[model samples]
Target: MRERVGVYPGTFDPVTNGHLDVIQRAARLLDRLAVGVAINAGKGPVFPLEERVELVRAETAPIAAATGCAISVVPFEGLLVTFAREQGAEMIVRGLRAVSDFDYEYQMAGMNHRLDPGVETVFLTASETNQFISSRFVKEIARLGGDISSFVPQLTLERTLARVRDQAGE
Candidate 1:
């Protein structure tokens, strides 16, 4: 039988609890999960690629260690579908938190399917506790000096706030 490998691609400036939940659940469904950190020069990231990758690696290590799932941290520079094909991933795991996200993700899934006919997409709903979490929202909240401890992991919250502060020159 062919291995069920999944590719979870995202910017993941700082991996959050929500992302962790998706990765943990996806790991159970697939033999291997490649967490692809996408790099888009058009969209300037608050954290550098290395820092973002390290954060994701650190946050996901425990789950990978426990589940014995082959987890890899790689950068996706070009087309995401192409990257998934290169990694031999049969599925692309995505998290949907709202109707708006569903619409966007659905469109992207279609595009990916067109690019790679063999690859499929699996959508996972965000846990109720994380339905309100989003990187944009988190960054804006921290930029406004608001607390976001409830929405993100403690370690990630601190790092996010520091990055926001630095970016804002506060």
Candidate 2:
């Protein structure tokens, strides 16, 4: 059987537990997985692309080690479908938090299909505990001095808080 390569693309402003859940799940399903840190300048991410990729790499290391799934964190710009094709990924894994995410993801899936008919998209529902957690919300909570340790990994939370403090000149 051919190795199944999958791409999970996201901005990953901060590597949250919810994102980790999806990564763990997808890692088990594919022979190899690539976490693509999208360079979305439009979103104005709090963490730079390099930092985002490093955070994801740190958080996902154990998952990859335990599952024996080859994984790499990479930065990509331009169309997701194009990136997936370039990575030789046959599947694009996405995490769906709720019904609200479906419409946008569904449309993107269709567009990806049109762009590359060979690559398929698979959506994994976020774990119940992580369903309400999002990077944006976590960042908001951190910026407002709320505890966000439960939502994000320890290292990620530390780095995010440090960055926030630095930006505030604290």
| lDDT per model vs. reference | 0.86, 0.94
| Best-fitting candidate, scored by TM-score | 2
Candidate 2 lDDT tens digits, 30-149:
999999999998998999898898899999999999999999999999999899988999999999999999999999999999999999999999999999999889988988889998
TM-score per model over all chains: 0.93, 0.98
Let me know the TM-score candidate 1 reaches against the reference structure: 0.93
- Tell me the lDDT of model 2 at 15: 86
Stretches of candidate 2 exceeding 4 Å from the true structure: none
TM-score of 2: 0.98
Model 2, residue pairs in steric clash: none
Ten contiguous residues with the weakest lDDT in model 2: 161-170
Distance (Å) between predicted and true CA of 77, model 1?
1.0
